[model samples]
Target: MERLSLNQITTDNWNMREAVEGCARASIPWIALWRHKVQQAGLAESKRYVRDAGLRVSSLCRGGMFPAATKSERQARIDDNRRAVEEAAELGTDVLVLVCGPAPDRNIDDARKMVEEGIEQLVPYAVSCGVRLGIEPLHPMYAAERSVINTLSQASDIAERYAANQVGVVVDVFHVWWDPDLYRQIARANGRILGFHVSDWIVPTPDLLMGRGMMGDGVIDIRRIRKAVDSAGYTGPIEVEIFNRSIWDAPGDEVLALMKERYTQHV
Candidate 1:
């Protein structure tokens, strides 16, 4: 319970102020914020809400979408990432999760190189702003549209290219639970893990992007994965990041209650 952090996406209907207040009311010590919600609530107000509620900002979701057809477009993404770093700093969190986007064309290899280059460009700014960039690999199902980095090993490979303090990997169970080499890659991450997210991969997955279930309701061995992350020395918040539409449609308080119950039982 102490390590549990409610990610804003887990309560999709709630705005930043409501999410902050909800965390405070639930005695949740930490909250992982999304950039859109922060932008909606106004950054200063969102920061104030978290500070006043005494809830820590676990990590800002996200700051990477590096693939583009033109160099100018890629540079624009880098510029936005710098702004994201500033937002993370203002929100008082050191970690910024990066969901590296898919290929601009069909050349995934080129897109991957672009990802590395973008990270290289952003690292200095992130480091200056006291932020650590967390590269999060999405599930392979999202390879065509969401993210090209689809495996923990790939994410770790990118992170290893930079100083550990400047870049690291974010382990999200919904994305990596299917990998046979997950445990080995997790072990390889070691001190390079910046964040850990927990959500289940439901059997007969309904949607590739929004099929995540509560911790106890799916096929993932979440506790085992949590143990592996713990062993890897990530003592940070275990953020609950679910994208299911049904969960989002439910009442926020009820969703949070169920989340806590499932977290304790399964994760």
Candidate 2:
């Protein structure tokens, strides 16, 4: 319960107030917030709500989607990222997770270039706001529609280009568990790992984006990965971020209880 945190998407239907209250009831120490949830609850009010509930914001989920057809659209995306930085800062969180966007014409190489360049432009603003950026690597299944940053190594390469305090990598078990080089890359990340997300990867996943399983419910060697992250100098919150439809439909308190139980046993 001390280092365990809940990501807001695990309870998709709960509003910011409900989520904060739920965390308080469950004795969860921290929470990772999604942009939409904060926006809907009013950023200032949401911050107050979470703080009042004695919950810390672990990291703000999503600030990047850098690919676009036109230059203006790309700039628009960067502008949105700046806004995300502001929101994270206002919410009193230091880590802002980024999902580097895919290329416009299926050109993975070009998309990769765009993501790097876009982050280079955003880093100054992020630093000025006193927030750290954690670029997240999505699974290859999302290569065509989501992030082009598909591996911890790629994310580490980008994060290495900046000061570790200003930029880092996010390790989400559900996304990078299949990589044979996962442990190696995690060690390479060293102290630059800004966030550690824990979720299971079910074999027969039905949805590409929302099919994540709860910890211990799938085949991932979560404890092994947790050991690696801890050994790599990350003493931060171990966030539980599940997006399964069935989990969301269950009662929020019940889901949180299960999360607590699983964290004790599995994580």
Error of 1 at 245 (Å): 1.2
Each model's TM-score?
A: 0.99, 0.98
Candidate 2 regions off by >4 Å? none
lDDT tens string, model 2, 1-267? 799989999999899999999999988999999999998988889999998998999999889999888899999999999999999999989999999988899688988999999999999999999999999999998899898999999999999999999999999999999999999999999999999999898878878888888888889999999999999999999899998889999999999999999988888
Query: Model 1 off-target regions past 4 Å?
Result: none
lDDT of each model, Cα atoms only? 0.93, 0.93
- Angstrom error of the Cα, residue 41, model 2: value is 0.9
The sequence of per-residue lDDT tens digits that candidate 1 reaches over residues 68-129 is 99999999999999999999999999999999999999999999999999999999888899
In the order shown, the candidates' Cα RMSDs to the true structure are: 0.7, 0.8
Q: Where does candidate 1 have its weakest 10-residue lDDT segment? A: 16-25
Worst 10 residues of 2 by lDDT: 201-210
